[model samples]
Target: MRFCSRWVVRDQWHEVCLYEDYFLYRTRAADSTAPPEEHRVENGDIADIGVDREGPLWGITLTVTSGESRTVPCPATIAAPLLLRWHDRD
Candidate 1:
């Protein structure tokens, strides 16, 4: 996968959006219109990551400081590209 852009805010993970010809993988604000927060990731930190693709849906794991992870389905706009790019990955 190739990343079109990456962002960090306030020294923590804010969002990451990876893009290809037909797909985009993004982690964005829940409100859609809210300004992105400031976070940063330093070296040696264990960043937990998860990805899921089922049927027409795609999901990614969201990890909090508490160690619990939540899998959230990608929105339709994102799902379309995800599926297209995933097949390309193969």
Candidate 2:
């Protein structure tokens, strides 16, 4: 699956997409003029995948082995599939 998103306000809009073995997400807010940031982690670079949900809002938190964490807005429906595919790259 392939998906892309434009810049959105912080804590407002978030989008996460899977492109083959690559994980792409861009939801910028620090500077609206700036393009969304793209993050890619190879297999084994991931430490954990977390979900944050409140009312109707949902987000995905990715923690890498380096201890860095990034969050992207995600739909509740894709949350499970994304987690499974991310961890089970095989």
Candidate 3:
């Protein structure tokens, strides 16, 4: 499966993509030639999901089974659907 979406982190927008088994994300300035940062997580790797409020912007926190966590700012409109997709996997 493959999916891509833009997310905000530290007030900057980034492109986040999930292709096959990799969760790849990178800054817009990085461009296509730049090597993107990759994260490895299977369906069950995600252990928890939570909403984070930063003023008017909404974000999400993902806790992995290994106890590592990552936070990314996402619009409320996309949060539910995205989280639901992951939820359905487990």
TM-score of each: 0.35, 0.60, 0.61
2 versus 3: better TM-score goes to: 3
- The residue-by-residue lDDT of candidate 3 on 3-26, one tens digit each, is 667765565656655555545545
Shift of residue 48 alpha carbon in model 2, Å: 1.6
Error at 7, model 1, angstroms: 15
Q: Candidate 1, 64: how far from true, in Å?
A: 6.6
| lDDT scores of the candidates, listed in order | 0.44, 0.65, 0.63
Candidate number of the best lDDT: 2
- Rank the models by lDDT, top first: 2, 3, 1
RMSD of every candidate to native, in Å, equals 9.0, 3.6, 3.5
lDDT of 1 by residue, 1-90 (tens): 343334332332333443332222345555456555443332123134446767554565544455755555644445455345544543
Clashes of each: 8, 1, 0
The prediction achieving the highest TM-score against the true structure is 3
Alpha-carbon shift of residue 28 in model 1 (angstroms): 6.3
TM-score, predicted candidate 2 vs. hidden true structure: 0.60
